[model samples]
Target: MQTTCACHPLTMENRASAAIIVRLTGEYRVPHDLILTILTVMLGATALVAICHRLGLSSIVGYLATGLLLGPYLLGILHESETIHWLAELGVVLLMFTIGLEFSLPRLLASRQLVLGLGGAQVATVTLLFGAALAVAFGIDWSLAIILGGAFAMSSTAVSLKQLGEQNELATTHGRVSTAILLFQDLAAVPFLVLLPLLGEQAGGIGHVLLFTLMKAAVVFVLLAWTGRSLLPRVLHWVAESHSLELFMLTVLAMALTAASVSMLAGLSATLGAFMAGMMLGETHFRHQIEADIRPFRDLMLGIFFISIGMQLDPAVLYQQLIPILLVIISLTLIKGLVMWLLIRGFGYQKSIAARSAIVLAQGGEFGLLLVSQVISIRSDEAGLLQPVLAGLIISMLLAPLLLRNNETLANFLMHSGDKDDAKNAIDNGAQGDDDFRDHVVILGYGRLGRGIARVLIENNIETLAIDSDPRLVRELRLQGEPVLFGDASNPGLLQQARIDQARAAAITFDDFEHARRVIAQIRRFNEQLPVMLSHPADHDDCEIGDDNVIVFDSEMESALMFARQLLVVAGVETSAADLAVNSVRSHDYSELRGVGDED
Candidate 1:
């Protein structure tokens, strides 16, 4: 005991920690390098996103840039790790689930004209155009042409959803139309995924195999749907009654992955299965909770998915095919955007909706990437041609957000370019705002913090419009004669109803980080000049650049700094020294929260 005890102070505990680490790194063959890669990827993403935010771009762009910077095409810090791929796959699954969660049977039925009709026409038209051009112009194989064309016909769902959700435009007329078209694309992807091998083979009947797969998938879907309709709600209800959050999360994941696995076993895409699972889960009362719980996973996975996409663009290869890449990008964007615009307008939407929706859905989608990958896997001989198209598709996705961000300007230009009638609303009743609200503040979240903010505003004789998701909270607030509404601030309709455009300022005092982000984002989209205050503790790198406009009340950071200053004062530090020490702590806290500018 004496020999090992005090000589090294904590030698035994330190030895044990080292022993465990060695065991993890060496004994059981753990993926230490993979862990390192993940940490770096996150750090790199944070930095890139901070920079991109400062540049007034979406965070999705930063994730893509991170992949390119660290991928094999560049520094090669993390090269094609299977872990990253797995994360990307999970992200896609989560994305599908979210889409399903947001959309329901009733909503879908209401939008059938766009989802099935306009969406179908766009996909078919674009595929035919691209395929015919390739087969005729380049004389490529008909099979390869079909695969590539179908891929190009699809638009990036991840990019579209992120951008639209950020702007809280998913409920707008244009947003609805674009969303429906995307849903069709998601469903349409299944056939292409199955048909690639069938079309590529020289076998007796690839069609037979595809038919068999579809039959199996249909049977599986029906069975899962039936089970969902009958047993899922009860299961979720029982779990909810138990009040075990961890258990509930586990059950949700199990059900989703299980259904997805069954679908994969039945020869359909796992992503499709996840969508089905979400549809089934959407029927439960726990849908909102599930949506909230799965958000963090969805976001992390989405970042990884985007990073994987970025990794595909090798600068050298892209430069070699620069001309072809540019041609493909222009053609895809122009053709697809035009088709979407015309199709949307033909469906009775306004010219504004039609034009913006067209630009929004014009890019090559994630489903397109899926088809391209499947074809390449089945027939590697086409990789050379497919790679260039892949680059073009990714470039389009990167540009899609920018196009959407400035859609109003672009749509206005289109209106003034020749057709001014489109600029005028078909109906005056479309205006949703309260016309009399001038110099009012909009408050999101009616929690304790929100109530405080509202009270303070009212005391100052400032009018306020408040929104909260909790029905009970809204009822209570209304009984107290507070100007609070039972609405989701993340909904663009509510923001419009609150007259955000005419508001003097806005405050988001909610613990729900995701919802807060959406509220801020919607505000940004609605009135980029508006001053908004977000009452969240998270130092989200993506929102750091807008700190001035999107003010964050970081109470924790302030409290810590205060504590440090007090400690210094108590330790007999002079008043000036204490102030200096407090300032240093505050600055350090801020630096910890934000990033150093473009740290090379």
Candidate 2:
């Protein structure tokens, strides 16, 4: 029996390229150099990221470090190439697409105030202030300064949202404020990007170029939006019917890339096109599935993108201009943060909210790097300032995760505020008169279980306060006059505002055992005697809480008990007897039902 070889037969092009490949003793012609390059990057990324993970840092830090170590600056193994650049850019496009999924047109319109008002104010003021400073300090042309300023005004949407989300603070006031400003910044980056090339190519007639670009952008947006609204649903429905995962993935990629290409061809940012595509698909029923399917691609690509960013930094240049880079980083993080705080405070937000928002958005953004790169390409004379600014921005991005992780602490320290009560106060504005809700239930994790509990409690004329980390849910409930506040329930300040100490009982309705435990721990910290009830799946081993006042409700077990009770009643057993049996099982904490359906 003959075995088939998987090696590609060497043709003319292969022979030409073969000179670049190291010969190995195998019929299978593997590109050893390419494999080795990929292996080196992967191994470096894995080792550094693992260390970062162990040290409780973001993986992005590790990716950047990997690039720095392997890039031309240090090891000389990897040099910047267009292939890598294009691939890295694709990563950003996918990222923007995913973000657009979360911000549908309706949601965008709903948040017009933040997206337009606070967001508009933030972009305009930061641009003007930074532009004026650069003009005075560097004595650069006003147009160049303004271009650089627009870039500086942008905070990293990818960095801020991901870091804030991991901390479970996305629903907090600062998180909301940061998100709003970032949304507008993403929108604001498009025009700047369009103008960058025009400005670089020529010094005059920029207004005409910008106006033309905007018209093209508007046309492309409308076409994409219309396609997404009408054609996309049917196309996706057909894809789903085919029941092919590969096909589905390909289709999603096609949509994203096609949209991006169209925008790029039209002289607009590719990310804007991909983002719009995502927003369009977000309206379809397949949004969740699409998001889930695209996540792995987004994450991997985004890692590559960050690594490429790291590769761009020149260590020699960095060392030569250390002081200036340091100053730029400080101004970008500290002075920029101050500006944001003042701006947000002017919007009538609490000091804590304002301060935290400032910290969250202090760093320079990816768009800023894009602008700086353009300026460098056009004005090599300004490399002295531009290079340092670029380096400074990357360093600030590296620090962003650490800053966001401790945003609350930093906000408190910077504002000279003692507690998070102010944050709670700011979020609890909707619950104004409900502060007097004594002897009421405080429900955490207002999903199905929490809402069910609230309905029953309200039906019985008992006041109840519900805390959920879902901003949309909180908004909806608030509009309906429900005493719901958007926040992480585990925060002591939020719990305090919920009057946890004064409540008759507290319920932790989260399905995750660890998450529920955290809320319980926080509640115990404040009100040691408050009767706490937590929900968990039936298969979980018996909880070992030391507090006797705490109760555990196993959802699966409760359902089984109800089913058994109904079966008994249907079998002609007395209603009282069925109730007694169920009550007896409940009294013993369902010990007999534990591990009843084990597969082993």
Highest TM-score: give the candidate number.
2
- TM-scores, each model vs. reference: 0.67, 0.69
Error of 1 at 374 (Å): 4.0
Q: How far does residue 502 in candidate 2 sit from its true spot (Å)?
A: 23
Give the alpha-carbon lDDT of every model.
Answer: 0.75, 0.81
| Winner by lDDT | 2
- What residue pairs are clashing in model 2? none
Candidate 2 residues lying further than 4 Å off, grouped into runs, are 1-29, 135-143, 241-244, 374-382, 417-574, 577-600
Error of 2 at 67 (Å): 1.7
Cα lDDT tens digits, model 1, 268-349, are 7787678888888775445556776677778888888888877866788688988888888988888778877777778888
> Model 1: runs farther than 4 Å from truth?
1-32, 138-143, 161-172, 194-200, 348-353, 415-421, 424-600
| lDDT over C-alpha atoms for residue 258 of model 2 | 96
